[model samples]
Target: MGRILAIDYGTKRTGIAVTDELQIIASGLATVPTAELMDFLKDYTQKEKVERIVVGEPKRHSNEASESEKYIQVFLKALEKQLPDIPVERVDERFTSKMAFQTMIDSGLKKKQRRNKALIDEISATIILQSYLSRG
Candidate 1:
């Protein structure tokens, strides 16, 4: 079986995660600049067999789409246009960033290390992928 990839899209940078070939474990992959995201994905997918993609759907606690959803929507459209074969799925991304921060603390990362926004983004993507995996 192929791997399942996940994305945590942001205006500046994007987080990426991927599961193993058996789709059992999720791990942080990379944090790429938003402008380079499509190129990175294209190259990665070409090198590896991706069965599906899970994108974090930003939403507010009130059940409304967050302001950032507009950006993500645009990315989604481009993703669909660029990669027409793999299916895409969405998972609620509420609290993911917060959860990632807490996870960093719980894991005993130093203050300086935890301040890495790119690392947090990568962890957030892993969390999104793990949530999807657990749902099934």
Candidate 2:
């Protein structure tokens, strides 16, 4: 069976997470530059046999689409076109960043490690994927 993948898309960087082949465990995969996300996904999917993609949907306090939604939408379209066989869904990403930070502290990461934005992004992606699995 193929694994499910999740993406926490950002303007400058994107965090990636993937589930185990049985789709039981979600783990952070990588933090790549946004400009290189498509290439990264292509290469990753070729090797990982991803069945679906869960992208974080940026939302505001009022439950409206956040500004980042524009970029995500564009990327989503291209992703769909490039990989029409794999389905994609967007899950609410309201407080994943804050949660990621708290998770770092909870994990006993040192101050310097917690300060790594790339690490936070990766953790956030894992959180996003976990949220989708729990909800589904």
TM-score of decoy 2: 0.97
Q: lDDT (0-100) at residue 44 of candidate 1?
A: 99
| Highest TM-score model number | 1
- In candidate 2, list every pair of residues with a backbone clash: none
Instruction: For model 2, give the 10-residue run with minimal summed lDDT.
Output: 42-51
lDDT of 2 by residue, 1-136 (tens): 9999999999999999999998889999999999999999999888879989999998999999999999999999999998899999999999999999999999899999999999989999999999999997
> Which RMSD does model 1 reach against the true structure?
0.5
Return the clash pairs for model 1, or none: none
Model 1, range 1-98, lDDT digits (tens) per residue? 99999999999999999999999999999999999999999999999999999999999889999999999999999999999999999999899999
Q: Model 1: what TM-score?
A: 0.99
Q: How many backbone clashes does candidate 1 have?
A: 0
